[model samples]
Target: MNEQEKVKFFEEFNNGLHRLGRITLIAASLLLIAVPFMIGILNDVSPSGTGFLSGFAKVGIIYIPVAIVEFLVYAPMLGVGGSYLSFLTGNVTNMKIPCAMNARDIAETEVGTPENEIISTISVATSAIVTTLVIVVGVILLVPLQPVLQNEALLPAFNNVVPALFGALGLKYFAKSPKIACIPLLLMALLCIFVPAAINQTSLLLLPSGGLALAIGYVLFTKDKL
Candidate 1:
């Protein structure tokens, strides 16, 4: 196919994928919300609607901002197909995103390109399948593995998994674009050092840190200093 034909084909395929993804997500969300209510009704002990709403609001208030920030920050890197699968599968930060990044690195495709989209989708799909299998296996083995998992010595290692994963990923990108990385790195370091409490709300902090990096990069490019 020629360039225009190829572009049209990709657009049509992406739109179809999006339609299916949206319908699946809607159905899944409805079932998740309905099942609990259905059980409560069957048990003849329906929860107070007000109480349920209040509880949902409390949790949603905390996470809504984080979810929005993550979407904006990750969508470009993930593209349409990968974003749909990754969001559906969960574990975006620690698993799917890392898997997609490694795939992109291996494929040598820039983010937002068609090649990157394909690589990201394949990477995230593989990660999601593996993650699901691991979860199923873990659940099946839970009783047998409880003691080992609950071991005091292993607790520390478990807690550091996220930090270690991000540290290694961040180092690679930092080396590639140290100038662009510098401001955000320093900002995050200062936030961690002075307002250690902010660590818990890392998603909220991503806006300013990422924005600074983007703004600096733009300015440097305009000034021919990059």
Candidate 2:
């Protein structure tokens, strides 16, 4: 189809997808809440109202900010359909983000385009399915794999999975735009070195790190330095 027709079609498609995503998310939320309530009702171990509220507040207060930040940081990169599917499936950073990025790169689609959105959606969906299958297989193999996995020689490798993944991904992006990436990379490294506690609260650190990068980019843009 022509550009106008294509854009119109994508808009309609995205609208429908958003409606379905919102409804399904609401249903999923209710079901999640209902399961605990139902079990408590059936088992006669219901938490006191005060205790429940207090506990919910404790966890919610910690996670709510992180969730909001994650959405703000990731949504632009993920786009409409990809965000819907990735958020629904979980594993946004470790699995879905990388999968979508790789798909867009391989397909040579610029971010925010319909083609990129479609590729990201498919990539995230496939990643989720593959992740689920891998989990299932891992569970099935746990008994056989236990000794191997628990080996002391491999322990360090297991512990550094996130760091290793990010290091590789970061290097690739750094190569792409070293000027933009260098600020955050150095800031994060210094934070990790001096503060140390920042490593444990990486999610919270996203705000400052991202803000710094954006501010630097803005300065560069205005000064014609980029």
Candidate 3:
């Protein structure tokens, strides 16, 4: 086929993907909401409307901004299908993002390219499937593995899982461009060290860290230092 025909085919595929993604997301959300209400009805227990609103407001006030920021930050790298799948599967930061990044790196695909988009989508979908299977297995094994999981010797490892994951993932990028990463890394480190509370506010802290990185990158770019 000609280049034009290929382009048209890809566009059509993307359109269909987006449509399917939207419909699935909506259906999943409705099912999530309906399940709880259905259970409540079956149990003949009514939840307090006032308490529900109050609880939702409390959670929303914190999560709404974070969700918006995450969408903006992750969407471009994830592409349309990956973004939709990641958001729907709900582990963008810890699982999907890492999976997608690793896939791109392994595939030697650049972000924003068609190859990267397809790789990212496949990576995220695989991650979701693997995660679900792991969860199911974990649940089935929970009672049997209680002693192993609850072992004091493994506590430290469990606690450090996130840090270890990110550290390993980040080391390569930091090595590649220490100039762009060092300042933000140092600044955040200092903030976390001094404030301590900043560690708990990592989601909120991404804004300043990201902006600082962007500004530094821009300056370096203009100066031809990158």
Return the TM-score for each candidate structure.
0.61, 0.61, 0.64
List where candidate 2 sits over 4 angstroms from the true fold.
Answer: 140-226
Best by lDDT: 3
For 1-226, candidate 2 gives per-residue lDDT tens digits of 9999999999999999899889988998899889988998999888699977866766676678789999999988888878887888898998889889999999999866899888988898888889899999989988888899899999899999998998899889788767788889888989899998888877667667767877888888899988
Where is the poorest 10-residue window by lDDT in model 1? Answer: 54-63
Best by TM-score: 3
| Model 3 residue 103 CA deviation in Å | 0.6
- Tens-place lDDT per residue, model 1, 75-186, is 8878888899888889899888888999899999976667778899899989999989998998998978889988999989999999999899999988988889998898
What's the CA error at residue 28 for candidate 3, in Å?
0.3
Candidate 2 has a TM-score of 0.61
Error of 3 at 197 (Å): 21
> RMSD, model 1, all Cα superposed?
7.7
Q: After superposition, how far is residue 177 of candidate 2 from its true place, in Å?
A: 22
Candidate 3: 10-residue stretch with minimal lDDT: 54-63
Which residue pairs in candidate 1 have backbone atoms (N, alpha carbon, C) closer than 3 angstroms, thus clashing? none
lDDT of 3 by residue, 90-138 (tens): 9899889988999999999986666788899899999999999999998
